[model samples]
Target: MGESPHAVTSLPTARQAGCPFDPPAELIEARRHGPISGFTHPGGKPGWLITGYDLVRSVLADPRFSSRKELMNVVDFELPPAPPGEFLLMDEPQHGRYRKPLVGKFTARRMRLLTERIEQITTDCLDAMEQAGPPADLVTAFAKPVPAIIICELLGVPYEERGSFQAQIETFLNGETGEEELMAAYTATQQYLAHLVAAKRAHPTDDLLSDLTNSDLTAEELQGIALILLSAGFDTTANTLALGTFALLQNPTQLAALRADPALTDRAVEELLRYLSVAKSFMRTALEDVELGGRTIEAGTTVVLSYNTANRDPERFTDPHVLDLRRQDGGHLAFGHGVHQCLGQQLARIELRVALPALLNRFPTLRLAVPAAEVDLRPEIADIHGVKSLPVAWDA
Candidate 1:
């Protein structure tokens, strides 16, 4: 409980009860202690946690820091290299080899071109919700499907298999399932993708994964890429939609501002991303001893980049806790930073820009069906924090 800047403790700190939107109180306090603080990884290894905006961003951009899984010093045992084509965890040429080929595929213009299609998808979801009537679990009914369908379709996941695919992904990524279940789901997903990649190689389609099959990427590499896209493509955006709506509903003034002017849609999405920061934290290991935040991170030391706290840094944003949809300050680390920044960011932006406003417009009376405190939240241990089932209702 000491406020010393060098405080070290086990992470991740729990979010206070009834305060789901804020970072864990301990994390915020740790940020107050200093941008960076000594910590112990869950495996009992010495580590550091980065919570300040500038420090987090700088570390993300620093090449001396390694994103490689094999290099992480969090555990005594050596971790295997990330599966083939899992570029996010690799450094340099290996990362570039996988990432560069796909950069042009998700360009701003390409994502922008998908707006009409995204709008159509959003409208379809609203139509389904309207048909189903009020008091629905928005996670299952709306949030999950919007991104699920888009990503599934984009990845060329067979229509007949999407339900299973979605369920498997939810099982593994939600972080609630047991270790055995998680590994089973993960193995199943990898097996399925391997088959899908082979199928695409023989019978290619217009989707992104199918397109990648034509390149020199091996089947294993293609499968890894598919896993990355499918997981990242849906999980983050789905949670953002559900959690952002919760934040807006909680702050009626911000809700009113967004509903009153559709032009605020873009800013609202960005602001919500900054405020909620559902992806929480990521780990990076130092390749060599490096000075950061006035502390020396020794070689192989893994640091937790606390995105939720960094996005809420007081020095970075005025009134950091307030959810101002019109917030002008723009350099938030919600989608991360540097070479490892989210590749699907443009697509996510377009989806949020379309989905949130449409949902608000469709149900003008939208509000939490149960008391906000009763809403079930995914555990802090979940890779992405969000509501488990947001039971929302409007005028019947």
Candidate 2:
């Protein structure tokens, strides 16, 4: 559904300095200029990118707009037909039905089960990190592993094979360095999950995969949902962990606030997610004729909603660029708003809340191992944006 004649006003290109997926100084500067605007994607595709806080929120909440993943680009990746029964691409009634049963499992109460496991994982990673000496790349040692291990445990993944899974996910997210590698990584992940799910069917465990297998749903449906869980659950949380740490390091006042009152860790995580906008942008195809922010959007046009831009809209947020954890009204669209608001947010919050406070309390002297600006943040590689390497120094 992409041949719509909907005319959106032309705005500047969405290209940031380092990567297309990141929010550069330009986009932030533009957000201050206006709310809803246009931006040419790097490939010269005229994308109706929603930047205004209220406008972005309206698009996500509106049923007239669609979030199907296929209409991204006709010339893009030629993968196999998406497997059936996977509900991620479904809109409206179908999307609602698929998500209804699964939402309960992600509640704060259910997520609390993983708190101890998260701590154990964080401690193990840091313990090994201490053995690595000072000026360590925390991305490899702590930031990366903490959430990976926690997610693995939450989904009942075999922790022993964590290295292989981590490698696959990394290749997929490393947008610039690995295209061929990304496809291979995705295929390997499917095979790995296929084998893992089959085993779970035979011997049911108390994990999400096992639960999905044992559910009354069809086999195909189980596979589709399981694949979504693996892709979204792993990549989003891992990005947030690294990006959130980098954000706190850059803003010591927020870091110290959490260090003082660890109970506010949950709120601080929300603030971090709001401030960093780690997921970047999501694509949508127009399902029918609809106008947004004075632009005539016809049926079947592709539009991109930039969470990074919307999160910092000054109209809805005051001093939008700065990282303010004490903000009471800062309900940023770091997670897309409306029906597609990240289903896994509760799980992500628990993981981040547990890990960040633990790290700060444990490593009191923690600081960046390199200059802040030198820390590379290339977001254009994948659907998610974050740091590849986060270096830090602190005495054990």
Candidate 3:
């Protein structure tokens, strides 16, 4: 293996001031230097940071690089294994065990079958926005509720509780909440899911979680699985819709292309997913020594895969920084790659393909209600990056 590159000690938190959609300049620079670089986790344990597109994708597909949470050696203290069904943090056959049963649930065909319902939900949101008049905070009015409602239905969560459940999720993910608030929200969600799981066991319904009850999975495992699905399903797509709209409004030419040709919708959705890549970085640990990008990842070492940078890597994309709806390039890591790739990706695609155009078509004059700079953004430390509230307006 080649000599390791010097470590970039800190993970970047600041995006270039005006470029909210871009990865931090430091990360882009790191990718330019080399695919793999040395790093020190905030906890002071040494690790690798993989920023290049090819390298990130390669590492994600490598079984020698484990995803087990307990195996992550980033900190000195021992960390517990991921909860029972949180398989994203586990390696196979555990990961495969959890993921395989649910594959049919999120198949492209299954998600596509929900297109009409997604249309109705999108329409309902636009109707509410129209009724409420102009200058609405799109985050609350449209983005958050659309996906929140869908995930709740999928999980068999009671309709009436969705509002509070959504709030709790936001509190945990928005990245600015105090520790007490964060813990409160997390505890509430866990308690709610526990009760929800028992309820599903007692009385199965037509929903995905209800269906999973037939599996040998224990209630605790079901709760963990629900938590993963709920968090990933709602948060990622919600931010993509909100932030994608922001990007569209900023680039009117691209927006016009999407609006003018419904045929562009699918391609546009992929581009937006790639461009936003909001669920930024993911960490993996080497189960044994592995050579990647000409450097050795020692056994039990953690590596941070920078998704946003990978999506924007100039080597893999032409004019990587620009968002073009008609651009033909695909295979972005927005939903990730390999076995751990997002299961809900097809569902997310349907949401965007249905929601964005419906939104744009409903309000032709849509534009930001506040100055671009004044739009509140989630803190850089947030697990997901996006606007806190997108204040948007259209002709009354």
Candidate 4:
């Protein structure tokens, strides 16, 4: 195959074999091989993959690295620039303006209201799981639904309409589409939010959707904010539930520790986010041409921030490769750092802090129905690393 039209310069003929991301230990080994790594990404311009924690934080916090794709410092799937829609894709000033007001919704006090809702949703799901018996796919039965329902309630998306929304969210994320398809999904999501906002406008409620509708924000801004809350709020939490369960099941000591004292589960949840680093990475582009760590990034060059790699950087966290539920200062960029840090992070933390303790306490007998080697993992997905399915049984 000839070089892709998108390839600006010669890149490594191919990147690493197997998964570009693997377990924490394996990735530590991969990073030891280099600092700034290069990989041939299908037919696109080769991507620059950063594997260290401090480097990722520096790249993310540095305004010189732009998030604008047309600036083109990095490449993904060899695709062209994604038209602006999601706030996540935009650079700061613009990003900060849009990202500001929403911070009010994520405070510990505001997020505390979600605890009861999340627990109720979790319990209801677990009830259904027990009624169905053993050998269950936890992803579908427990992990996926709890967060979806919670987000729907938060967004005031009609509960009955959630299934279709869930499917569309997955489709938009699959990334196999040309830009048109992705844009359509984004537009469709905006229209849906616009309609929902209209509903809340006429008949407000005590939810984020209502607050968004009634806020002094414009229609487009409201829609963009709501869209992010719905998709990210659901997807990230679902992955955390599934992957965290896996970690607990595999490390009996960790599981037993949490079970023995439910108080420790909060820390376990932090460790899980750091360990799984589910949000993978966000992109950064160069604002002006700059050089660092021996690589020259031109004005508008794109960079991928490796969240997974940062969480495991040995320089930041001792025994970074090992899962320590009690580790303090988790010192991980799992939630990211700097101004663009996740707005919904406190909400996510609340969900896990509620879900895990309730889950392990209720399902003390929970164990994996499949071997570790048999579990399916997907690494190529943009911004998130997730299990395709997680099978578990109540073998107690």
Residue-wise lDDT of candidate 3 within 1-396, one digit each (tens)? 235554678775688878989998888878788888888887888888899999999999988888999988878898999999999999999998889889999999999899888989989998999999998999999999899999999999898899898899888988899999999999999999999999999999999999999999999999999999999999999999999999999999999988899998999999999999999999999888998888888888999999999999899999999998988878899988999999999999999888999999999999999888888888889989999999988899
Candidate 2: the clashing residue pairs are: 6-298, 21-380, 35-52, 175-381
lDDT of each residue in 260-331, candidate 2, tens digit only: 887677678877788778777776767777877777666766677778888777778777767877777768
**Per model, how many backbone clashes are there?**
0, 4, 0, 9
The TM-score of predicted model 3 comes to: 0.98
- Kindly report which residue pairs in candidate 1 clash with one another: none
In order, what lDDT does every prediction score?
Answer: 0.91, 0.72, 0.91, 0.72
Give per-residue lDDT, candidate 3, residue 132.
95
Residue 257 lDDT in model 1? 89
Poorest lDDT segment (10 consecutive residues) of candidate 2: 1-10
Candidate 4 has a TM-score of 0.86
The 10-residue segment of model 1 with minimum total lDDT is: 1-10
lDDT of 1: 0.91
In model 3, state the lDDT of residue 386.
Answer: 96
Clashing pairs in 3: none
